[model samples]
Target chain A: MKGKPFFSSVVQKLVIGITGLLLCGFVAAHLAGNLLLYSTSDRYAAFNKYATTLHDMTLLPAIEIGLLVLFVVHIGLTLRMQFQSQKARPEGYAVQKSKQGRGALAARNVMHLSGIVVLAFVLLHLADLRFGLRFNEAGLAPAQTVLQVLRDPISAMFYTVGSLLLGYHLFHGFQSSFQSLGFGGERLTRIVKIVGILFSVAIAVGFASLPIWVTLLRK
Target chain B: MSESINVTLKVWRQNGPGEAGRFETYPLENVSTHASFLEMLDILNEKLINTGKMPVAFDSDCREGICGSCGLMIDGQAHGPDRETATCQLHMRRFSDGDTITIEPWRARSFPILKDLVVDRSAFDRIIEAGGYNSINAGNAPDANAILIPKIDAEAAMDAAACIGCGACVAACKNASALLFVSAKVMHFARLPQGKPERETRVARMVAKMDEEGFGSCTNTTECEAACPKGISFSNIVSLRRESMRAQCSGRSTR
Candidate 1:
């Protein structure tokens, strides 16, 4: 990325691509960790304990730093891309309409929906995970802390719904990112589609299940 | 079914940009509903030519809808009442024999009216020239199957290239946004392996030219697709945004 203008629209997209891949990797790891909640033995308990060990002392700071960096880059890149796109057409087309074809929804609303997910989910996620678990001054035990939020049917439902929305974002976005990366070709297209579906489903199910397992199964 | 109907046509008649323009009305009887709109226009023009008057000037080449040249605003709608047919392909069955049809040229600051209904759309050509292609003018044609592109990507590129460079998109857009048009071109080239070398440059320059051409921002109203003869998808536009972002990130030089 040397000769290109530093703040060009393509650079913004590259930042988005890099940060998006990081986020996707994080989602994969988080999904794997979330599956631990289903374990019936003390292993499940131990897993939580170990997970919280660093999360309680070290991981939180590192994660907050990493997340902050990723979010800033991701969002900054998005804003720049959008600005350039707006600047691309000054006076605008005299005859403008949605392109007539198969992809009306994903084409028109992906950006708008992605924007909504970031704003609403970030606040909700911090409250649910960051503030509730790590930063709570009340010092509720991790299990009790988790249960406190999940025990409420409404809160649990909200978490589930939010996770589903996250899945929708990832569903379209995962495939879209691969397309942007120039990854798809005749040999890998089917694989990309399959991986995209699996990734979205795994993330949605893992996240959605946490609330359900805590609220419904415990009751 | 042999009923003779009378209708008045308010057609835009402008000899040149310097000349005063007005709508001229013509009365016609026994217009078959089965004829295409351009065919109907042909009937009207033929009548005028027989009367020793100059036939109304409009653009219609490759009437099958691929060339993207035939566009008109019929009764406030681009390409008449059809959902996605070109004016040349639009049938008169969309209107009653007695219906008054108002035909107007595509109106945009970028697309100047050359004469009558024929507007000079070379602005699109200039935009394409500005950076709508890959620098890989690799002189020798490479083996067709050498690139190893996924069929899906190839299909996507083909979809973007389906754009016929018709100005219907400009006519249908309220803001006169050229995002769809520019995006289609950008995405078409950006999606292919052959296009990767100059991907960043192509997007940057094309977008820059699009802005210079005075096209408006896209408000997401899908009038362009409805009026499009080829029914190019809006997905190509999204692909454009994604590619633009990716290219900007990669720091590739624009050639």
Candidate 2:
């Protein structure tokens, strides 16, 4: 009733849901920009230009700070919800039956599990490409840095696996975010779910294709 | 008619609230296939009374399943195995001979165990008391046909109203979320013209009460729907989310 930041579980879920959708949008945009690395016309010139444009933008720092806040709030609320749910049932049932119509087991429980994996991958990825910390030369083109990283089997494997995990996490997180925001109606829910699946597939495949294409196909 | 079968019931036994509980097995033989689940329990109680042992304490009333008083987790399924059936409506014939059935009370932080197989469901009552009623002055009853509600709205309202407050949804949810229960009441009231007057207050108050009662948040797992004896849809939770947000954003509160 009072105007407190932390009110109830429903309000917490609403915050988490809205922020989650915002993060989803950020991921989609990020993937689109990353895909420019595959442009054939220029020898990584276009990709470097795109990276420079993003870096030069005055709003970049503010956007980065906002993203950091979103991640912290989303993960914090999610962990709290998980802990409360766990405590609600302290004792276990002798024989438990699996629920119906809830989708795959991985999709249901992937939030916490895949979330950690994606977090670790993000840090490593930023270090390698965003900060150019792994490269001896600091001012290399974005494409060259990406190529250099993917050329290593360990980095490529991690990127590939991380992309797949991100896909799984988004696959459920997308539609669930909509539902949490109270978007309901038989037809609308179905459409949201379909769009969620397609978007998840696109982001995952798009990001994964980068490393695979750089390592195997690009001359 | 199906043949009668023998069953071994591993029922949970607890002395009282905050007391340690354990499974006590009772072998019931030649239970009538036509007898309802409560009737079978009655037979077991009769045996216990004759043998001078304390009878298993369970809650039940209106053996036809309308009162919402009788419920038990049979073999880990809320309200027994048959879909859309309450425990009182379930027959002993559903069980196979020599089957070991594990019966337990509704385990939830909100609904504390009062004794063996009985929990204090006052939390649900408090949630209802929070805002489950419409404010109407006492007067001559209005004509039933005066407010002609559309068939679709009436049906939807009835669907949500079918919830008997049995607490099966809480019992079955992995998170022990009462979203299904709260949502049903929210939808039932929100859909009717009579209930529109206090719709905002009803949703906000009920949700707050549900949280205050120590229930967990709904992660949309939907185990509650699968276990619901009344077949209440999980979509109501979606409606509840929308309604609650609308109220909060509008800065409306009855607190």
Candidate 3:
């Protein structure tokens, strides 16, 4: 088939939407696992066990590699698309107004910026617990190291803000993924939008709750 | 009561495509509130011609707004400040006296400036030529009621057919994408039984042409729909995305 390139504009957008939705799914699963921090019964024994179990899994490396591919492809396509869109209009208007409401415009425009913040926070998170960079790990449990990282005011504040920005990113992205993939019906779109808002709130509050908890009661 | 308004127009003036363009201010007096936006331009053009100056060049026909020939970026808003109204349909009553109205052409690499406030929208025509019709000869015209289409499909098809191809969607889109226009054409036929034959190849070829023309990708901001004079919904763009993918998968001819 002598067709268009595999990565045409439409196909680029299709891949981006797929990868973004997959990342959102990963974030939800990660948030669920992180809730083990609230296990105060065994002094975080369950949380530590969960961490160790995840580390010892045979498929952990493959899963991590898959996740890295998703992030790289998703973020790479977005940067290229954004740059091309800017070039599409070399000379912009002297004055321009959004027929779309100002608030909605701002939300869609800030996707890349918010995505950057979420990426940085995720890296910071990995440094603290995954790589043991924040504290000495000679005899420390993952939960204990997590507490040390969250105890630092700067780290806690960054996590809180980053989590909120993630919610902001997903608010448009969750519904946007379906549209890009051409998944729509009369009622399906409205339902996806409503659910997108709820999911965004759940993720933001769920992740931010950790730092707040460690800062306050875990002292 | 009808009234007259004195207004200043900051119109974009470009001598040629390669030449640098600038805004020239013209203070017009005694413009009738009942006059359409293009009529105000006519008054200004007459004054310029009377003074032996080159009048502004623009596109307009069927001043009643059906031909999709008139478009302008007035005061930063596509088709002026009215909702679902084309530039030709915008009346001066919406403006107050002493208002400074800015006029510019559609700014996009694909839609080049041909003259003052007039762009070369032939790129849209090229896309239409790519594969926007059913050219097959299946005999004479069939009876109107011979083809039985469901009511919902007819309404949906009509909704997609509302696109007038005025290029306002392109002008107002932040990405300067023409997906709204392209999708409208795709869905216009795809909703009815007559469009199913060329559905796969049509989307593929048109999308390739759109990319070749350097239009940006859709980000689903719904800005295009808001700018559309006919109020064409953004959902057509979504359906086009599906149609393109479907073509790549099971089409008889890829090109």
Q: Return the top candidate by DockQ.
A: 3
Which residue ranges in model 2 land beyond 4 Å of their true spot? A1-5, A101-106, A132-136, A212-219
Worst-scoring 10-residue span by lDDT in model 2 chain B: B135-144
Model 1 interface DockQ = 0.07
Assign candidate 3 its CAPRI class: medium
- 1 or 3: which has the higher DockQ? 3
Best by TM-score: 3
Clashing residue pairs for model 2: none
Per-residue accuracy of model 2 over B166-233 as CA lDDT, tens digit each: 99999888788999999999999999888887888999999988988888888877778988889999
- For candidate 2, the docking band is medium
**Which of 1 and 2 is ahead in TM-score?**
2
Question: In model 2, how large is the Cα lDDT of residue B203?
Answer: 96
* Model 2, CA-based lDDT: 0.87
lDDT of 2 by residue, A176-207 (tens): 89889999999999999899999999988999
lDDT of 1 by residue, B1-255 (tens): 443455688888889864667778898777787777788889999999999998999998898988988878777667776676778888766676577767778877787777778888898999999888656675677787866889988988898888889887877775566777888888887778778778888888887676667665553445566666677775665567667767656877354
Question: Whose DockQ is higher: candidate 1's or candidate 2's?
Answer: 2
Interface RMSD of each: 6.5, 1.6, 1.1
